[model samples]
Target: MSNLIPTGRTDIEWRNESTQKPPKAAVYPAEANADKILKAAYEHTATVWTGDFHNAKQVLAAMKKRVKRPSEKKRAGGGDAVAERSRNIQTAFHAHRMKQAQQSRILNMLAVEIGAGFTLDIPRAPDVKAALADVYGKPNDAPFLLPLNQLLGFIGAHEWHKKGVEIPALGGRIHVPFGVFSPLRGEYLDLIAAALAGSKFQTAFDIGTGSGIIAALLAKHGVPKITATDTNPRAVACACANFCRLDLDNIVIEKTDLFPAGCADLIVCNPPWLPAKPSSAVEAALYDPESRMLEGFLNGAAAHLNDGGEVWLVMSDLAEHLHLREQDFLPQCFQTASLEIAEVLQTRPKHAKAADENDPLAFARGREVTSLYRLKKAV
Candidate 1:
């Protein structure tokens, strides 16, 4: 953790729940240049303290620019390093992930201390009490330290929650809370909307229902009763709120791992598509860590489903393109789970990243297809 001290306070004190002793503090001067700050951050892992909030942001930007800037040798290579790595898609993907992890570690070294009531003592810092409360709930008397990047994320999340994302399929907005996954990509939702159109499904289960988008959509399409479950408390709260906002009274949100207690006519899950470990809570929406969630959903779907019920697994084929999973993996999982694919509905991504040729993974993103895999118990 970064040792962020308030200005004009010389005495240093650290508080924590851990039994281990705190490390010796490394504090940078307020007027330190970005190059000096970057050197300390990258080498000694020093915590930065700035009385001027704007200067801190500028230093962070400069640090990022310097860290990401390619070396002179790479510049002389005629083509960028990413282009060279693109020859092997898997290598490129892993390298990209490594770079991202490295960047996060270095950037997170820039820290700030938030006092009780979520007040920032730094000059030029905007009032973030509301945003802090939204993300961290009620504040305690003790002050806390957080990365400047994460503080920015909380502010952005509050703005997103204030102005919800519009879902064309539901003709309503779904406000996503901090730490909850927002439904920014509409292609997967479109598959659900199309699948549920004019459907007579009575009861449904939305597994891993982040923000309750799937379950809400199910209710909007006339499903009488729906049970949505998520292991994340934040997601459970966010989903419940969204359900109320959409005026969908039939959906019940629960803080369970995946499936709720009884059988249902339909079960839907959009698990994290990547088969990699997530670095943060929010990244859980993208990385599944060895496909645990996916395998769990497939293995348990049959037991919690009624006769003739269908399990709609929404996923993208980007994993295969990146060599993260084999083409036959899903089929084999379904077979092992004694489930058969009734229908596979596919939709190509319409997101900007899919169309951006400059993206390192453009080859994979271009061919990526989001699919609604309609599966059922095999006799």
Candidate 2:
């Protein structure tokens, strides 16, 4: 793989294992005594929270009082491995608390119970009908869950006078329906915004336009015409709703795998960065194992792009640190896709992973760089 491409020239770099000190905080995975954890959790009361979602609400409520707000705590001064073990326990406890919180939330939102099969007890509403139809496709009034989180978001958006959550980068909030991925929370949105700010676009297409954030930004940037697409039906509906909420109906959204139709002067894509299978639907926006979506975009870009037009592919090398991707994998992608790296616009991430020293992958995460690859069809 090293012979396939030289990495010395690129803006990205692999982990320097030698320079990194053995991480100060050590965690004993097995040393975590379940009995001790459970006793602490129940406050010596009955073990209402042992290890399942059945008592999730109770466990999470108890955890909230104990877990510190994900902090390092004034450096915690010096401590031996035991002290480090304590910190690790704290971190793990924090993670457990969070998992419980999520489980509780999901359990509470299971409006429709599943017993025998796919039966759902859906709440009837005007928008609910559309949401149900959007997810179920020609309702049988059968028992099926319609990605209620997004439906709830849609419902919430309608009830609230505001359009959506505010994005300082987009200069406003984008109403992200329950499932649609929010771009404002991460650096990619800001990086994409910065890259597009100095460039002029006559026509553009936003691939995988979750929540239509990029498409909306393009329209706001004064691009005359724009087209956006997503394979997820919920995302298609969500993006459309957000476009309407932002009053940018000019951006046409379609349900497609990667590309829509003819070429445009500029194309933008923000693929799932991780090369791992997502655990659930909402996680799809973040995890794309095997780089399926990323590869698809690169492989198909040459066909959809107009001559001299560039496809701005947003990427990050953090996956490299997590041992998820090979260092040369990205360059090999450009070569395989018959695309040339015209320019690499990169920024060291300000995200939590970069600042976290206690993280197991801190060495890699600390040096992670997020970049927008300005790629073009090879002539």
Candidate 3:
């Protein structure tokens, strides 16, 4: 039997000690299986073993393509194409959920096996046990089971950590820990760097500092002191780890909802680009339902800025192009917050998704642009 218990704010713990074990981890059942689950998993995780972080993403994309289409052709004699597509989508969703659940159970079982090795003085499972410890922060003996997908994700992130991403603008390679947000977009950083260069302030505040990249960039560019804040525990850990790695511990990393009560000469925020509900916790990068982060930054920025101070807001107009948000509402927001726009620096996205013509939102993405706006609190 499995016992459900609350562990952390974001995760639940499942303790299963019954003789009847949980389901086996789902894998491609056979080499000849049409779904090719094993092949996909191997390819997606190969970079993890090799320390090529970027390539792992490419492999995952390829795997997505394999399971994309429905088995029945559109021309098959089975109802309208739209209905068939919907049915196929529902089927796919169920299968994906089941696979994820089974995989989680399997990994839980593996964790138990690793724990037993340590408990019974078994000698052969050191590597697997050690890897699990490295990622989970505990030996296999712990009565908690992590989701298999999450375990795989951590393993992949560890590989990326080993490789490390370089930020030329900051003149440093930032070591992002497993499960931290990596700075994949350079154009945004360029805009931020430019904004920092143009600003006259010496002190700055970074809101929602995921990996503290922006704060680090500001510090690297000669900002004397910076207060970087994040609400997520993982992000806070990530920021601290990155700051220590870059030797920027002088830039204080704090766990706060947004601002930590003080005024700075400059305040900077890079909120999520779209105002949509995130599909998963990891998708926070692309979604900010109701524009919570953006609105909070704007509303509270004035109070946290010194008189004549500036707030630099970096965001993309893709949401507007998608008809998900009003394009003209940003200026209105500033007006409501009693702030005035000082200057706007814009840049085009360089990611392949922006240029891929086959993308569902290609038409909108091609015309999309990211901007860095410097706003000042009214006198």
Candidate 4:
């Protein structure tokens, strides 16, 4: 039980969810020192294997308490320097990301094994077969190592997927699958609904439609025809499942990046807000990595618009506040795309993070404004 069997062929080819190179793991019992585990993880990028479910949780927690964040006062030279650095949004943003990345690296070092048939052999371990199937499909013939933290995330996502997210605008819930972007924040959905209210389009396109919430919203708004597209096969499946649940037969779900073929009178896109690389598959919905998706949508939207049509670009200004993107960037993109901004609908974020003083990015979140840019071909 100490050894993790590979999912395929030889036991040497151990698999992890991230698909990154497997870390060298050493079995650590419940009595293992958390400080020593942290030191090993940091120094050698080693993984800790434990069979005690509760002990793994406790040890991971202990390891977290031992992990040190860079001392802001020491790094900033103390006193007014620390306060000045805190006020500098860009500096604080990068520091926050770095700290988060480091913490994740150390914490993910704690791992657990799943046996064949998706079994958790540890005492007091909850059955995760169903949740594992939800994301990874049927179990492989062999066992694999999974980060305990990521397993917890999978369990939580399973619960959320079971319960589904309540979207008041759709008058129902949207079941977000594991690794798909959940619509925890409803402000953006409200903006979409408000934009479509009392309006009719012959045809519509929902770009990068994760979980098909926006496409469902469009269908609910009485759009006669709609095309929803996503680059992720999981998202495409998620969207298709959601469309079926909503009985939205008119909308077509396609596995394509950004936009589908043909033109539409109305095209709605809620691109990733930040201009940064995503560390994980889920973060793809949050970070755009050099604004590639945003630029693609803007650059390609014009060619996919019918006469007298409008393209609605939904985004947030949080990146601007963080200095990740310049304030004039979108305007410049619009100019280059030869699209005229007809109207800009804006709303302040009401999420808890927006008001949480303890949040590292609170400065940017507090000033964040989500907007729906209604654009048209320049006359």
Winner by TM-score: 4
lDDT of the candidates, in the order given: 0.81, 0.61, 0.64, 0.81
lDDT of 3 by residue, 3-74 (tens): 333322223234332222433332211122213433433332111112132333344444444545454333
Candidate 2 per-residue lDDT over residues 70-126, each given as its tens digit: 453433223343245344443543344355444333322212221123233323323
Please write out the lDDT profile of model 4 over residues 293-377, one tens digit for every residue.
Answer: 9999999999999999999999999999899898899999999998999998899998888886656665568789999899999
The alpha-carbon lDDT assigned to residue 125 of candidate 4 equals 92
Question: Per-residue lDDT for 62-119 in model 1, tens only?
Answer: 8788888566234324445545655798887897787777777666656677788888
Error of 4 at 163 (Å): 0.5
The reply for model 2, stretches above 4 Å from the true place, is 1-58, 63-163, 358-361
TM-score of every model versus the real structure: 0.90, 0.64, 0.71, 0.91
Q: Give model 4 RMSD, 1 decimal.
A: 3.5
Better of 1 and 2 by TM-score: 1
- Point out where model 3 deviates above 4 Å: 1-66, 70-135, 142-151
Predicted structure 4: clash tally: 0
> What pairs collide in candidate 2?
118-143, 119-143, 120-143, 150-178, 165-173, 166-173, 275-289, 276-289
Question: Pairing residues by index, what is the TM-score of model 1?
Answer: 0.90
